[model samples]
Target: MNRCRNWRAAAAIAVAVSSWTGASALSQHKHVSDEELLNLLKDAAPASVFAGATVLNMAPDGTMKVVREGNNGWTCMDPSGTDPMCADAGGMEWGKAYMTKGPAPQRLGFIYMLRGDNGASNTDPYATGETPDNNWIKTGSHVMIVGAEAKSMIQSYPRSPKADPTKPYVMWAGTPYEHLMLPVK
Candidate 1:
């Protein structure tokens, strides 16, 4: 009789432990909606309008500030803030269009872009063709903050280089275009 009671008690504890573990996993993978993400950005950062662009103000939190020129392109503030980063032969590939959009609720990761007109080609005249994978922000498992249009561009872009004849442009922040990736608690 004592053996039977001990067995039942162990079974109950096992069930409770299993339930708690499942709940914790579910919370970790919780999907964040687009609107919810935007609200999170607004609440976490001080936003401001700059020259027809809505700049999501990132505090002096180790990374530099980046600005979007609508969907046209993106530019970074010079250390002095007087002149814009140059669109050299390798133009900025990650523009405002690539940073704002949040990932679909079903997706696990998000991407952000630096602004430029050179499409996605590294050899293009205005190519700032750096991939999101190379960006400092995409290094870890932190939540990514991108502009709405930029997010859409990344989601729509072809995943494989051979799949599409045209090379999709890549964008990087912090070289000339600075973007931030903050850890989400």
Candidate 2:
């Protein structure tokens, strides 16, 4: 009887190990490569409109950073924060998601920013509520985790830009603002 019990226990252990190995193998195939991720970004809508912008790499924390060639060199900008160009909100959120969750199969998040044909410029077209300056365009749907996360930090303003009790705040979405989330693919 004792021998039978030991055999049963050993069989159970073997099954458990086999199950674990199979699950691990499945997970390995699900991982998306950095190059593939970059290609996805290149194919995104508004991001593709930019002249020579390309997807960078995933940061250690999971946030991806992208740099595009301006007239001069490479420039990275985030027009979502109060100090959009310098703020780190987007990077932080991306890192948090990556640390808490494993790598995603597709690109995650969207960030809207101005890409200049010539180079980096100090113009705020969205701020003026007018057409963007020449050579400047609102670009979005990129795979940069940091850039996408930054869009979430933009502030919504009141209709009057002052004390309006009814319509408290207004924020542009899908147009001026960038939408960030996991891609279906």
Q: What are the models' TM-scores?
A: 0.18, 0.22
lDDT of each: 0.26, 0.27
Candidate 1 lDDT over residue span 1-185, tens digit each: 24233233222222221111112221222233334333433332213312322222222222322333232222222211111122110112222212222222222223222221112221221223355432211121222333333344455443332222223423332122222233332
Backbone clashes (count) for model 1: 24
Candidate 1's C-alpha runs over 4 A off are 1-50, 62-158, 161-166, 169-185
**Residue 144's C-alpha lDDT in candidate 2?**
28
**Best-fitting candidate, measured by TM-score?**
2
lDDT of 2 by residue, 104-181 (tens): 222233333222111111132123222344222222221222333344443343222222212222222333322232
Model 2 poorest ten-residue lDDT run: 78-87
